[model samples]
Target chain A: MTTVPVRPPLVRSSDRIVAGVCAGLAEHLGWPVRMVRIGMAVASLAGGAGLVFYGWLWIMVPTADESAKRNARRPASPIAPAVSIAPSASMPPKHAAAVDPPLWTGAYSPGYPPGAVSTPPGGSAPAAGPGGYTPAAGPVPSVPYDAGAPSQPQEPSAVPSTGAWFRVRNMRYGKEILLGAGLLLVAAILIARLLGVEVPLGTLIPAAAILGGAAIAWMQLDETRRAGLVDKTKADQAGGWARLAAGLALVVAGVLVMVSGSGSWEQTWLALLASVAVLGGVALVLLPWGLKFWRDLETERAGRVRETERAEIAAHLHDSVLQTLALIQRRAANEHDVVRLARAQERELRGWLFRDPARDAGQLSDRIKAAAAEVEDGLGNAVDVVSVGDTAMTDRHEALVQASREAMLNASRHGGGPVSVYLEVSDGGAEVFVKDRGSGFELHAVPEDRMGVRESIIGRMKRHGGTAEINSSPDGTEVRLKLPAAAEDNGEGKS
Target chain B: MSTPALDGTAGDRGRTVRVVIVDDHAIFRSGLKTDLDPRIEVVGEAGTVERAIEVIGRTRPEVVLLDVHLPGGLGGGGREVIAGSAALRGTTKFLALSVSDAAEDVVAVIRAGARGYVTKTISGAEITDAVYRVAGGDAVFSPRLAGFVLDAFGTAPADIADDELDKLSARELEVMRLIARGYSYKEVAKELFISIKTVETHVSAVLRKLQLSSRHELTKWAAERRLL
Candidate 1:
């Protein structure tokens, strides 16, 4: 089994079919999400049921869960140092972590080649350590974790291999197309049945094949050409806006086929043919762009998740990991103990870093209860989450849950005493309240230490386009977050 | 995917520097171990604050390359490293490694008692150099960061007048003292219970109010004032 880089579930933007697997894959492989979607659509069209099979594969592919990840050992493949040029001190770390723009998006940073290393100009090299490092004199075998290379003596600075983008393959596109085409066939069959059209699998099979092929072929050819008929480097040089425009055009073509009307037996076949042509064309012309767009969306979402995870990881490190390491680093004269502590921190760090960022999007009541449990864990205080109005909440209810959790954390961390949390839905909106019996203060004078308050409650609420109100005094504080029923309104605004 | 574990560094007699890398990304850690020479070795890597500590006890790498944000904790969470018993003090060096050169993160890690601050963008070579420098009983600050440290400590001349310096809060003055002592921004934040942003604000305030242009000026003034 090919060992996929273990990552959190949500950050796996390449997974789009079931909770954004395609999006997760696109982000992971650094491809466009729209292209993945389009390609999958085309593939399903071409391969018929094969598309469905691909979707199944997506669902079955084991996503590395946090618990399993906590125990897995990361590959220590020795990486051969490439070069010894001085790294510029001014270059920010964020810039370093960001993928090479040209490789992923086709846009080039000013003065740099589309896929060149982003080294700053005239940076000073760091002072050499003890032995005054010897450079590589001969050919060095490229290994992922080879530290032994530097032990040999040579001449100039060893090549410092840094960020490298993984190449996205056409097979993935085929996989996506097949998956997409399968979905369309199923939907079409279901629609036909819903309309009370009597048809056997044998009869529908031929028609499905003909229509799916036509759709996949047409979309691929037309859209691929419109996608500028070039690869990533050349395409990115064209600009993101242009790529998006081209992708939209292909999507339009695909939509046209899905909706086009031609009812007669012969015309029905013709419509199927037309559908194939349009979808195939769309897939080819704009799928890459679409895939890229989708990937970016997923990436952004994952980035947020990653940020939160990082924050949580940071908290863990501050609270426990670093403290333990400090002890080992300072007073652990026993090499074994120090090594053990260091290893522990490393495990925790890897847990936070390598673990997936996706939250299990399950039932609403369960999720709320889970949120309550998590709050209790965080604050060491009991939390009660209640549901009002029988209608169930979906993952969409997370904003409300997060708001309540934040409020609870605030009450526990700074409200000066224990707290109670309540939730209810009324008047086309849902309300969550966190009430604490502890001493509170003026709302205007936000406590500097109250980061989680501003970030979790306020930030989450604002993102979901909701409102949070805080009422506090020396006696106690009550925090409430309200979400309008039309939360979907803001969902469409994301694009 | 179990690859062969390190052959338990055969009979290593002397102590090794325990280290942890904190960053939100894995690709950043890809070439880390190879970057540091024999003087420093990476025992583990972490993506968050909490896990970093957990692993710290397990692997016991002497230094941690701490990132500001991780999966389960805050960026400034590394304070536990500093506030811990002296047993942990000399054995580990929490060298904050992050994409955020954000003054807040820098000061925060410094106040957390991280021995050094270096951004992710630093070449594997510089990172290697940093590990060794920090290991050898010296505090390491990137040249650009040197100024922030000086400013945080308010190492300006007392003769510069109390009125001009009044713009700096008493907390800011405390930050200045720590900075002058060679603490990173992250360390400063942990020390002050302020965000890295607040720490930066203090540093900037001192720089602006005292009319001192660089860390060198602050250092000189502090030397004259006997602050260090």
Candidate 2:
């Protein structure tokens, strides 16, 4: 269904008849409102009875006064923008005033009524405001659910009608433009009347102000909504450009209008003339803040991108590389063979050092620590891997070190118990033992070809005339590796 | 078509073996391939599942050295080798060239029909001999891998033996062996067959004594000893 245009009820002007019927009708129809007023005036003069119709219509049609009541009765959509919370009275008046600019010095002051109650303060005790009076608890209004047409009451107290009036503030830009134009039109007319000058354009000023304000407000909301979806950095950059463009346009237009309106340069009013210059200066000053906001937004976006990349790398390593190695170890039956397989896998990974084809390079350290910590985490701080032989292995000796690392990696990841890594070094060689306090495997009975045993112990030791001795019973398992003295002493450290 | 007997090469040392190295990893293949000596001729190389198959099919060198793991799928290399068994029947022998010495991978490739299994870390000279040996249809496996295959084969159960027949005394076992060797009832009446009536008595005595209940067990027992 097509939507009918909905407009705010118009308020009466003072100089013109206090009746607001013409203004309301013009607002609803998108017509020249002045024309409506002139037509109504002519009608009243001709029949004199039209005044009675105006009074009846004014009483029957709803005004802005009913806006709050209508909103509270409306049904809410599940998906809607969060309501903006208004500030409390305790905030300095200056800070609160800066939040929403006023449309005019006179006319409407949109604010909470002095006696209006608020929702209970978020925390325990209630705090006093400027008046130092106890706040009342406003009654929450109940809404009627209608089967056919939905008409809602607007009020902060009514829960269902919130969405209807929620969109009202969206047109704030239009309101500001209208207020500015209206004042200008009234000023021009007053000047013409007081000076007794024939200003041929006086009649069209009010119409221009209302129409221009509506157009500007509509355009601004659309741009802001579109800008909000972009990454914060891009959004900030776009916002800067928009503000700069708007400022430049306003300054140029204001100067042109002031110059054109003056009959002669000598007759210009200096105070009003200086105000135009001030407006242009304000726009220029905003340019830098806009740029700063853009830069901050960009850095934030970059930070988020890096975080996601790191997570992706972690997942890749866990899912593919580590998992594959574990599978090989489990499938192998002999310890000697398992060691060989593990060594091969380790060597394969080392060969890809520069490229880190598996992409787990960053997360590998954490995975090792986590596997070790699993022993502590599961057993509740009962065990820990003290060190991996002083952490002083060279690239050539990495294969040997990796063997022990894999054993620790496996011991920690599997079997629930307290696990500790013990390292001993001498001129003879190095011996690293991964001991677990938990009940151990039934060796010689049901052999478990744990990859760590195969890859780390057997693989490393066999190459250097070293040997791994695993002694296990119902009590626990002690996996010990004895390395060749020559290999250990001469092994280089990893770069 | 056979490659000409490789007598010597540019840096001649001894008779060279024509070899084809197949592995999935470029770095590993390159590392291991460098070990090939002047005594070995590196004929071709393949680094993937399909490429290895194609390269081996075309080269048909003295030895089609391969790996168990290849890119297309897990154990794709082994499957390619085994499936090619029908076509490769005797044209070229497959020597599994691998960095893995896992018993499972080793046994798997052997089952998927590899002639031998060898690790990539082997020295150049040993690898050359491995290629030659496999090409000659002599099974070659890394010592550990060979043991795994041997154990797998050795664990099969043996045929049951007849307890009643085996219970026979040493003299009887020897006599049974000779009787099944082709001594007849008629010959028995003459020399070792026995005296005419005595031969009948001894035959009945032997059957009843062993409790075989039939002559089949006697025949099988003798056959087991390779006496028939």
Candidate 3:
């Protein structure tokens, strides 16, 4: 058993009858493609086991080039650094298109040239630009400028003994294909013997001759040109459809073989038992790698997609909404009107950012600061937010945030110059104190139309099962809000 | 953004009341200029506290249209600018034109010794009259702003701290007023019939006794205490 790399194994990008699994195996093992396909066909004719095994392989394997493209797009890979000049593997712009543009491109196209060893381990390099040649000292110069090489002694340590290296590396991927083909032939023999199909032990020699001739006719062609000719035999059929056709043909042929024989139930049972034993053995060997390949593929792709989405949203918001709001505020009727408009826009923008999934559960102190910053910008008040609690904001993040925002705005409106915000985690929850040094307003004296104190502050707190306290004097007014954590609320409720 | 005229509209008094508008809002400044008395010549305009000082130094206007809140040289807004431009004292005076009518804003600018405090809501003619009154050496304010100043500073010195004020001699107090009013040293010398050196001595002594840095801070210090 080959010890796989930490990252997913490479899959072949071209040449396949579904999922590029056999093609990928051929690349990994360097066997003639003819042998693998023949082995597959013979196994399929024994029963439906081979077809089922092939379908499993198709889903599990990620073609090598697809993995290479992923490698290029991924910023960091543990195995990548150990393999070669790994930096270029992460250069998406340089290699992504050159490798293969689509996820399933490998299943349809021919795998790279017989010269495939020259291709980067992370396949997508445009060195396909130069017939995939592995120049002497090739890997060291992968990145043209050679930026990181001088700093570390990584390469020489990696190369094995010269004789061993060449035997393993220059084998050019045929080793596994032949080995797998031989195994299939042995399994086919076992099935025949089980079926009471007369075994021609002497015919094995003729079968070898036939296999060799077929290998010679098509096997030497590894580059796209010959692979293209081989692919034409696929005849406008996608890999999955072609596999469907092959499986049906093999099943029909097997039925004829069976009917021509004794047609006994014992023969059918024997064939079924033999097929399961062989196919299960093969699956035991290949499935782990296939699962690893799929895991690697999903992880890299999902993360990249999410990052792209966030960047796009940020750019659009900055260019459109923010600019338009600024222009409107400047053109408003008077300073007061401008201030009011600015305050409203500030509130909306803060709310949007706070509610964004990325930073919604961040430190409550940071959220409080964001609210203070908005009021400071919109009203030109000096706001300082201080946090002293060791606990996180807990379940009341949004409600406490809104209530705090209203309090900050009120301070800017009715309070004197510098406004201070303090967050303290005392008891089982958080207390937010917003203080301003100014004459305080009479709670009862506030008009019905004013909502900052009533709806935004008091009402918001009530909804969250929190309490808001307002104290005023000639010196200053302080609004203190106590909010219980979500866990604490549940704990109390259960009792 | 308009270029304020260097010469005032001709008045029966026969003097062009040269003025510089130092408000941040260009549109409001221009609109206010259009409504001013023809006798008031809008000499120049500046948009920040720093530029206002530089523009005032060069033009030496009789009255400047200063905003109560401004950005640029220092953070204290109008008070910082008034404090920074000490050399232009007797030659020019500053009157604040602001959008804020809050008592703190009114008292703050008044303490900075703005000859007056008026809201942007005042009609053009009213602003013009206020400017002339300031130019003629009378403290002016919109009625409500005046009330804030009187309540805060004008009514009684008894509630005020006398520590800084007591440091000034009678002559020093007079000189400090001239300095805070934006009178140049030469003008102060001429008005007091004293040598320029004597006037300098008095100004520095007043600064030292008040624990102030420059004539800029002196004006702020005096205006803040309502000594002028």
Candidate 4:
């Protein structure tokens, strides 16, 4: 399913110096690639504004290959963002720029359009951007120019600046935003100093302290969030640790700045504040490692306790319940009631003892076994069910289970002693065979009034787009039910 | 407690079939020993993997009723016992006895060298028949074990000429289905117009394919389809 096709969707281009954001924008807007690159460089040097936009684009826009594959399957609506902004708002800025240049150049060159060499529709190539970039900027109305696209001078405020900032905040480039803000503060202070304005070290040092502490805290929070997402590569983990160390060093430097800046304060108060700052820095630095060690110890202790409890339970079961069941089976070997009761109790106890929690209760095997157990309990016939492979619970699978139950009931009713159910699930389809060894009845000879075989087993399967066949002979009767694979039933109502 | 006469008296005719019952549960072992038929004698018994290996090596019974899960010897269970008693492969056959419904465990023991697999819930008469069949150099296929073999080797390409060693023949598949449908070997022979010996031959061929064929797809299919 796709919405109205945007002729060339905005996606990150393969050709780029960094994460291909500016190249992608240039291609999308039919602007000169070099002009966009130069503009991005200028914006980045001007207090790190470009870095924020780069990180935001890296997080939001899919790469060319991703968009192409997505389009081939089901094109994402550009107007309506596919991923919600709330969960990602807490995500840390990914190190997209940390990707090596040689790998990208080698990988993306075969299928993608050449980034810098392609001429824009207005005939302004990257080489001619320095001379002819001005005329092209005025004509493009779809450009989302704001602080990020500072080179577009004609309609700088054409798009709402609030919208661009909203999208930025939505991406949640937490670390980049902090870095950009710190750069802006430094830039402002430098400009003020150049203009001979007296800048107070007292306020500056405390501000740096707050920013550094916030950066460290933000990184730690992001680490915790990402631990559950995907396993990080060793390089990614090392990079994160390095960034954390940088944040810690920044906080330490801020404390030094604070100690030097507080020359006018009383000596006792200064000593107290400095010692507190140093202790707090040490605690912050050691907290994650200490927490990790404590968690490991707790997990090991819990595992040992569980092991001991499980062994005790097994010993107790073997010593009491199992022994009693065996004794009962031997004492009343000819008594059907006592034997059946003991057998059922043993099955239950064995199941409880060695239950695998990973298998869900509603699985096909379990459902079939429950049906067989019910039939056995009701008719006093041994119903053996053996299943290979299983499918997720779907309506079609539910229908299969119902038909199997009906077949088992029929087998027990008409056919004599024991019933067997064999279920197999493969990629192609699922099939179940319920068989009984007795004098078989001819379906044609059965009166038309009997609804058990016709309605419950055959009709129900037909309604679910499956087929049911009954093979009968003097040897036995076998009911075969077959359902096609799930992929073939896409047009049907899944529920 | 005492080993039966090991003189070549166990046969398919009127002679007794010596059997060793190796299960982790002592109560079940004693119960099975009592429940066996008069023509079939329990020669030895063991509770753990190592003890089963040791007992089987010493008693050398005609058939060993092995459980799939055991407590000792690296936790490999019945497979380890079978491997440990490899020297007796020519004389002593294994019929795996399990209480659990896990197909992988059955498949593992079968692959190791068990001639057949049957659940513990079977009647004592059926177990005696299975032991006689194994002792007579015939592979036993309980309905559940037949279902497993069908699921494993039945999904190959229908053209038997392509991979005949790994794939089951159409006749073999028919026999397996009949067995899985609770047909006795005699009944299957009657239905297929073949002799009981031919039914045994087909089952033995399937068992041979299950153990000896080095088919990657077969291993993968068994691994993926059978739940642990």
Candidate 5:
């Protein structure tokens, strides 16, 4: 005999008289509709059991149209029915024979598209045999029967390949399967009690406790797993925390049920204590794993930071040092050019390497150094600057730096030897001494026409309420600029 | 013009000073050797700390012009060489030369028993003079080194006792300031109305205090005021 199709889901049919309950049940069970109707009528007259059963079925079983709508809304995998069903249809006869007959005859058909039952032709005929029966006269069509509904093509077509009878079609249904099994167990127990069967509370309560606890834990775990598949938001995190709490509560309830269901009061108390100790031991065992996870996270973050810093250093070297080296290589024959390039690159690198990230640009020491560097670049004369202390930049300090720069320029221009600049900031005042080993020219002997030293240096310092002393001897020329502490405060107040 | 005086002084001694140059750059060492006054003789050369120690120990040069930063051996560079040659501390004096004016580096080598510290930019005549002075048992403080010493020791903390050995004497402070202002020892002596011998004595005393004092505060002061 040809393998029969699986039974359809227990949903109310569109063809209905008195809510279509009998018709839906007959179609789900693959029985004649008239038989189920007559049976329901007889049961109602006997004890009103039929009405209660009918009510439960009506509440639990959605109508064909409603289930079809839900199928449309489900975010099922977008694989076409032809791709999924083709493999199952081509299953080897031996593998198909291995499928369990009882499971194939069940009233739930999760793999078939819901549209199979919602179609008018299929809904009206309960004798169509499981709503999945296609005549075996020709090759089975790869396309679903209800191809008109584009959105429903893949909705419920989560059919595992017929060759593997035990393989689940979708992992997302694990929670649903767990929930259904729980409800079925509860129903079976209740029905047994109704039939006057003596069900032991001892066995039933602990069994129910374990099953219920396991269901809740599994559902929460499945939800957490699904949530991880997408980006986690703050709300998802809170939900995760709530799930953890619920799982913990269920575990505690399970423990309590086991303890209470045991032999004697003393045994119950002992079991409760043992469970608490077991939980503590479990926690102690897991503590190191948690700490290791936390340390790994920190190490990963540090590695990322180091990676970024290394990238930045590499980029900087490529941009500045490497480029200068290339230029120097090309100009190797020019001794002066190579020396100048190397010197400039060295200065740039030194500044970059030793830069104080905390220092601001407006500090007195920075400004003086910039000034000295500027003169050295312009005059090709080396100016060595040594700064002992620093103060906030003020108008007086600015004047001092300016005077110092001018003195440096004059010294480098006229001084026959290297120049040195010293800056000292003290509570009494600030002083900048610009000394060059140039043959000294008398202050008066300097023609009035030379305004650089007199006007730029002396004049600027005087305007800022500071003093400039030019000491000249046969040894060298030293220009000393001094800013009193009171003048600095005055400058700050004025500003 | 100052060359004549330096040459005359060395000529009066009638012997060239023995020297060893320790620098990583071969070009720099050779250039320095060529530019130095004929009154100084280059007895040996080395490029690394271990080799420097070996040469300094073998040659027993009167002076070692040691680069503050060198390759090989312990990463301590010049300080390691000085420490390694401890047996020859009296006979061989170390004058640190560097391209950087970083305060901590200068202070570290000085604390390691370097007699003087000078930047690489010092003229050949001046380097020759510094070598001679270091050989003569006098400390050679470049203007920058003088500035660093002044800044380190000049600001006396009120909490420190008055007679702390690390504290610079008034004369030593004066000498440091003058040197920091680019005054030669002769000029400083003339400016302070003291003899050149007195200036040298004060500088030597300061150097001694810097090397011998086991003061954490001095080191902390230098570290805190690093010139970066």
Candidate 6:
């Protein structure tokens, strides 16, 4: 779906360090401003690309509120300027803010809802964060199911995907082919005996000699070519199930021929068919499973390799970012807002560091922690999150995290005291309970404009293959969000 | 805002509790200095592990607020500070104040003789109470961190067979650690001063033993086990 014409986040006139670009980006994207600036600064390392990019973003991208006014008047000026930027200098700074002075050091992240799928190759990488580590988003092989198709028309981005597939399809197995041929020859000999052909048994001697010569020829192929003979799902293995059934039928026919035809006409024809069927059945049933086992081994090996990569990333994050953030927290001065930002940033960094790539959110406990921190950062309050049971990583984790965050926000706004979050994970699924001691409001009392309770909380759970159970009274309010084990297909959230 | 830095006989018990805050960050130290319970006196503070040892030695505070990561002398972390101040172990207590609740950090500090390890999230009152408890020779840890300690050093550790680690070479272990932390394959290669090709080989071997599907699953597995 084509979203509304994109506009730059507004510069927080009150919180600008240098034109509030970083602040705007951070606020707009729910990312740490410092990281955004750092990311911009890092992007600059590409031979002043960062500076030039930041400059264009400054002049072109309108502020958030102003964009609303502009959108009302007309559609955005057809998505970005044609010659978006000069190769170097000689760029005009148009449509000045009129209030704030032009500052060289700022860029705002585009405004997107929290947990939205980040459309990249545009936004400052720092602003695109769950674990805040997309800066390292190098090439990833596309999924096997869609390896043949890519949505983007121009770019040929399926090289690695095709490469993996090619390796699998091209593989061959010589030993199986040779064995099949040998089995067929044995069946042929049995059939010939039953047929009572004019040729004697000595005629088969030359056939054996020819088979040995073919085996010798097979040994001449190179090691790689020879190894190809071990293929699992090649042409030789196709009608295995059919062959099994036919072999049983043929065996019955051969025995019948031996019994009935012996007393009447020629029994050799019946014996030949029966013996051949038995051979086909036994080979089809046993050999295919061998191929299946081999294929499983290949996938398992690949899985192990991926696991190692993830573990390495986690370890590096532990030593580098996690530790560094801790030290910074202890050392940095208590600039109230800065300290709060640091705490929030620390939690986000942790989340980003440990997140599962499959889901925007990682473990259940992690989602709870992130939601709690986000709530605390947005609304100044203490959220104590207690997790119970081993957390399972599931695709629905991001949706669940989103719902929990909204519930926490609702609690902090209406609830009277500290928010207590309890996350319970079990075999069936996970349940997050956000409880606050504040005076509760009736569910029906919520106004139409407010989307927190209705859409964010309840709607999110339903789309995520789960449910949100909210209970409130004068005593307090508790939002128990339930998630099913087999989560539904994602990305169906409605406004 | 109204009270002096110290009030006469601030504690109900009529005695002042002395403290030394050791952390690399100046702001956190200053904040701690102001927010500390009135009865607790901030005698001295240092940022590096070496200075922390010296400050704690000179101040001989009853309780030392230690951060896990510092600047000097053998990585200058809290565990180092605790080990350096072994001479004052019986008289002085070390309460680790850190942002990390990672099992590794917690267990390392606690194993190195920290009286307690509380995360920075705790409020001043809770920290003060923890300090007092540690001063009285009691051990303390964050609820989550305590679990890490138990899992790492508790009775279950032996059954888990730390020896399974023997199967991995030191290099492989290093590779596993970097991958587990969520580093990109290329980044791991750069950090370890090895070729990306070598990293891939090592990764294959590590995954083979771990029996995991991919880096994503590996990250989750490491997190669940608290190895990360």
Q: Against the true structure, whose DockQ is highest?
A: 5
Q: RMSD per prediction, one decimal?
A: 31.6, 27.7, 26.8, 16.3, 18.6, 28.3
Residue-level lDDT of model 2, residues A304-384, one tens digit each, is 789878898777667657975787768677654454455444534433322434343323222333444443444333333
Candidate 4 is graded, for docking, as incorrect
lDDT per residue for candidate 6 within A193-270, as digits (tens), equals 789855444534444544454434334334336555354465434444344445445445445544453344455565
The docking category that best describes candidate 2 is incorrect
lDDT of model 4 at residue A120? 19
Clashes of each: 189, 29, 23, 0, 0, 39
TM-score of each: 0.23, 0.25, 0.28, 0.58, 0.58, 0.38
Q: Rate residue A451 of model 5 by lDDT.
A: 90
Tens-place lDDT per residue, model 1, B157-192, is 344345453245566556654443233455567657
Residue B213 accuracy (lDDT) in model 4: 75
CAPRI verdict on model 1? incorrect
Native contacts recovered by model 1: 0.00
> Per-residue CA lDDT of candidate 5, range A43-140, in tens?
88878998997887788678988877765774432222221232233332222221222333333334434333322221211222122233452364
Q: For candidate 5, list the clashing residue pairs, or say none.
A: none
Better of 2 and 6 by DockQ: 6
Instruction: After superposing candidate 1 on the true structure, give the runs of residues whose Cα lies further than 4 Å from its correct spot.
Output: A1-495, B1-16, B74-87, B150-155, B159-228
lDDT of 2 by residue, B1-228 (tens): 001111111122355667677776777767766776665677888877767667767776667777777766454566565565446567766777665544456555655556666666555666665565555444543333322322222212223453343344333332332232222233324435454344334433443332332434433432232100
Tell me the TM-score of candidate 5's A chain.
Answer: 0.43
Docking class of 6: incorrect
Better candidate by TM-score, 3 or 5: 5
Reference-based lDDT, each prediction: 0.51, 0.47, 0.57, 0.70, 0.72, 0.57
Provide the lowest-lDDT 10-residue window in model 4 chain B. B1-10
Q: On a 0 to 1 DockQ scale, where is model 6?
A: 0.02
RMSD of 5: 18.6
